[model samples]
Target chain A: MEKGLIAIAAALAVMTGMVTGIGEASVARQAVESIGKNPDAADKIRSMAILGAAISETCAIYGMLVAFLIIFVLGA
Target chain B: MRAVFELQGTVFYIIAVCLAILVFLIILNMKLKKFDPLDEPKGLVLMAMMGVNFIENMLKKDTNKEMTEKLGPYLAFLFIYIFIANISGLFGLTPPTSNYSVTLTLAAITCIMIEYYSIKYNGVKSYVKKLFEPLAPFVVINIISKVGTLLSLSLRLFGNIIAGSILMSVVYQLLARVSALIPVIGKFNFVGVIVCSVLHMYFDLFAGAMQTYLFGTLTVAFISNELPEEAKGK
Candidate 1:
């Protein structure tokens, strides 16, 4: 049961990373496109995109932490 | 746990000493008016700006060319100092930020300052209205976002500092073992030293500074946006 739980946790971590990566990539791409259309506002758009990416990346980090806890603490 | 500090003493001392040096430098700059360009001749304005730039670059100046320049440096200084203090734990010293009270207090102060300034600059009515920006439903979302900022900022700093410290410890242990195998390689400790130094600078210094700048800049951006147009014009 314990091993099964660890497997589930690890799989969830991978999925979290994938979902966050996709979300951030799309947001970043749209931000760049906006900047390309309006060069004068590039700095504002870029900063917003970076902020979004940073926030999104937190999910992946949390996922990794959960995976580590399951593997090391739960002995899975 | 008690012996942890014994191993991390060097890191602690370095951080403390660096902070002391920064404080001293600030005092010296103030006393000497080291980079003050208030009285420079017209042609020397550029030179004066360059002088200011040089000092700022060395001292890790967090000030930008905007009105918030007055507040940026102090915020940056606090973030960098706290970050180093937290990461010093990896060297075996206890992370000050690991104490929830410390991080919570910092976050509270930042949130309070943001709200206080916004209200001060925009008046209560405008400030309250800002909570409902874009749509009425956004009022709750905006309030939650403010709370989320406090939580996220504190957790992000705490998480990164702790992780960096742990990674440093693991890398040190692995390298120590690798050096044990090659007796001659032990003499040239530069490899390990260089790698460790680069990692520490990137993880602790660069990221620390970036986080500090982000915090301060975000505060300024949020408050300024909340300000009345006339006040912002000034």
Candidate 2:
């Protein structure tokens, strides 16, 4: 029963990636549109987009960390 | 002592740092013949110049000319060290960045740089006041945000590299098992060879380069973000 619970918890932790993926998808879309409109500013736009995407991805990373802990530390 | 020394990733960390230093030393000691400005550069000179140009451009983008001049060498060293460490996985060594210790130390250094710049540019009075700004109770949240930058920076690099390495191993294991089901061809593990290389190209090469660039760029961004607007460079 405990093992089953651990598995479910791990799965739930990784589910945070669903939200993060959607967030970053929009970030990338807008970044591409901005670059298309201003070709000369592409470099600046690309860096800003990447930075924003990375910040948004942190919640998913934290979720993965928790999942790894649950599986490896608790389940073990 | 044995446990500390036996940490699996330490050796790789040392190897990566040494390799970066070795590259730096070799380039430092190089005696290049003077060439015409318009002539095509060759060999190590060309590579070294290209790397300098790239690092300088990156530094100039985030900070003022004086800040770049001061921080350029350290940031260049950082870029080289991180790139070497991240890509070391390609050569069969576990990338040191998969270890939280390595990433945390790098993040801590970045935090220190940010604080140092903030104090220097904004002054101690303003820095402390800004923390308590608009309300006194917000200090807790302000402190958390300061610490969050360190945690988030370290975890971003660590999680990405560790996840990639773990996934690669799992893929290899599954591929090996699948190949073992074949009769004679299973001995060569051809399935793994064909598929694992492509996966390595993405996980090791592409991810490593991207994370290295991101880490370096973010370090610059965080430091400059802390500086006053007047102090910020074009």
Candidate 3:
């Protein structure tokens, strides 16, 4: 039962990426639209878009870290 | 033909490699300074300049204008150090970043810098004052945010690089086993090499560069965020 709980928790942890994926996709979509409208500023827009995406990526990273800690660090 | 000393631990190997890289970089800098005015810096010097400029531009985006020049080299070195640690896997060595302890140590340093600047430049009175401003109970939330930053930054680098290395190994084992079906090339690791090279390119090179950029960028952002703009003016 303890192992089952750990597995379920790990799955939920990985699911955090779903939200991040949607968030990043929306950011990319808007960045593409902005770049299309103003091609001259594409460089700046691209950098900003990447940084924004990375910030969102942090959530998924945290989730993975939690799963790792539960399975490995906690001796579960 | 003889060994003078035996290095037994991973930590020692990491120190040796990092020191070698630093020494090589110091020599490169010495060479860079003697360049003729008529010619552009080529090879290592040009790459070094580009790296510095990249970090400089990221920093210049901050509202605190003074930090761009002051913190530029420190953050750029952070990028280079982490980049090498991440890519060590490509050379058949364990990437230093694959270990949690190294990443945690780097994060600890970042946390120290963040707190030091937070209390030092912000002034202890204002630091305490601002925590209670808007509400007295917000101090706990503010402290949690600080711990959250340290955890997230270290773990992101650790998780991404280790996942890459693990997947690359799996790819290698699978390819080697599958290659045995070919009688002529059964004894060779060639298929494993060719297949795993493609995987390693993405896992190590691309991921390594991105992790380095993220780690350095986050460090700069954290430090500058803690520093008060008005206090930084002098």
Error of 2 at A15 (Å): 1.0
Clashing pairs in 3: none
For each candidate, the alpha-carbon lDDT, in order, equals: 0.64, 0.86, 0.81
lDDT of 2 at B152: 90
RMSD, candidate 2, Å: 2.4
Question: Distance (Å) between predicted and true CA of B173, model 2?
Answer: 0.8
Taking the tens digit of each residue's C-alpha lDDT, what string does model 1 give over A1-76?
8788778877776577788889989998999889889999986686677677777777775676566677778862
Best by lDDT: 2
- Positional deviation of B6 in candidate 3, in angstroms? 15
Collision pairs in model 1: none
**TM-score of candidate 3 chain B vs. the reference:** 0.85
* Predicted candidate 2 versus true structure: per-residue lDDT over A1-76, tens digit per residue: 9999999999999999999999999999999999999999999998899989989988898898889899999999
In order of appearance, the predictions have TM-scores of: 0.62, 0.91, 0.85
lDDT of 1 by residue, B1-234 (tens): 466545443455655647755775576546555445475543335543554554344233222344445554655556455656545544546556655456667778878877876787678987778888889999889898888778766666656666677687788777777766777767564556667988877777676656655554555555555555666533
Model 2 clashes, total count: 0
Q: Is the docking of candidate 1 incorrect, acceptable, medium or high quality?
A: acceptable
Q: Which pairs of residues clash in candidate 2, taking residues 3 or more apart in a chain or in different chains?
A: none
In candidate 1, chain A reaches a TM of 0.81
TM-score of candidate 1 on Cα atoms, chains taken together: 0.62
True contacts kept of 1: 0.00
